[model samples]
Target: MLQGKNIHFCISERPIIGEVNIMVAPGELTAIIGPNGAGKSTLFKLLSGDLTCNRGEVSYNGKPLAGFKSNQLAKVRAVMPQHSEVSFPFSSWEIVALGMINDPAAISDRDIQAVMEKLQVWHLRAQAYNMLSGGEKQRVQLARVLVQVWKKQAFPRFILLDEPVSSMDVALQHLVLDFMNELKQRNIGILMVLHDLSLVANYADQVIMMKHGEVMANGHVSEVFTNQNLESLYGYPIHVEKHHEGLGLLVHSLPIHHINQRINKAL
Candidate 1:
């Protein structure tokens, strides 16, 4: 499991994140959700070892994150940030191949093609990466990260993503997330920062709701996704409805009329 204990970070002596703790258990899809300026991205950077924390520590499988050598770390976790740029004119396949640079023998060319096909980017394998659309580029990048931990390993592994499906259309978003769900069966922990509560509601096995760099709630989806918790987290009136057809929870903001009535009554 990947865990953070009392994680703290600061900017110029001002605290950005404080006393935050989280756990990403193997085979679980854990999501972090919060409004803008809630320090979601900063926390992500801290957990992925991109930025060392001002205080506290992060560990993977009981070992400190700082102790792992670069090569050893690559085998345990893969990270795909919110945005990635390819300065050179590399083909989509070449960009995907970058993930295996640490140990090319770990993944085969055939395995790479299979992952690209799963993401529906196999046809664009020869296309220039910089020339693809935003959503298409996102898929190619995801393919890159997926292949890093695609092969099963003796020890558990993890994939840390930041708003991975932000650019994809609705269908593609589900497709990518569905693929992520499948990865859980391989004993890989998945942690991502997501804004779409609906996606979080349906796809996430565990939820971590953050506000001002503090954890407001963290638990199984059913326990943390209450209307009350969401409203308090976002500072807006929200509603969570259970679908009569047994689909799942449907969440939305309260209607404008309801907001006005509540305000009038308070006054």
Candidate 2:
């Protein structure tokens, strides 16, 4: 499991994250959701070892994050940031192959092809990475990260993604979430920062709600996703309804007039 205890981060005396504690177990999908400047991405950076915490401990399977070497960490955890820029003229196939650079012999062309096929990007394998559309490029980047930790190991593994589906259309968004669900079945813990509350309601096994660098709520989706909590976190009125088919919860925002009407009724 990947765990963080009392994580705190600050920049020039301005706190960006404070007393954040989280746990991600294998075979689960944990989502971080909040309004802008809520420190969701900053928390991700701290968890991914990109930034050092001011006061806290981050561990992977009981070992401190600082103790792991770069290559050693690569074997167990893969991170896909919000933006990836590839200025070089590398083909999509080559970009995905780069994921296995640490242990090239452990992965083969067949492995790469399988991942590409699964992501439905096999047809674009020969195309240039820079030439692909925004959504296609995102898929390629995801494929690269997936290839890194594809093979199961004795220890737990994880994938940290930041706004991974922001560029995709509705259909592609579901497709990507479905792929993530498949990964969870393989015992890979996934920690993603998502802006879409409805998607969070559907796919997240656990939810962490943050505002102004502190955790407002954290628990199973059903417990933490109440309409009251969402309104407090977003500073606006939100309505949540259960799906008729029992797939998941559907969330909606109340317009200003509707919010005023509700407030008048309460008064």
- Give RMSD to native, each candidate: 1.7, 1.8
List runs of model 1 lying over 4 Å from the truth: 254-258, 261-267
lDDT of 2 by residue, 1-267 (tens): 999999999999999997899999989999999999999999999999999999999998888899999999888899999999998999999999999998887677898899999888899999999999999999999999999988867788999999998888899899889988889877799999999999999999999999999999999999989989999999887889998897678998868888789889999
lDDT measured at residue 122 in model 2 versus the true structure, 0 to 100: 96
The local distance difference test score of each candidate is 0.93, 0.92
Tens-digit lDDT track for model 1 on 35-94? 998889999999888998988999999889899987898899999999999899999999
The TM-score of predicted model 1 comes to: 0.96
Worst 10-residue lDDT window, candidate 2: 102-111
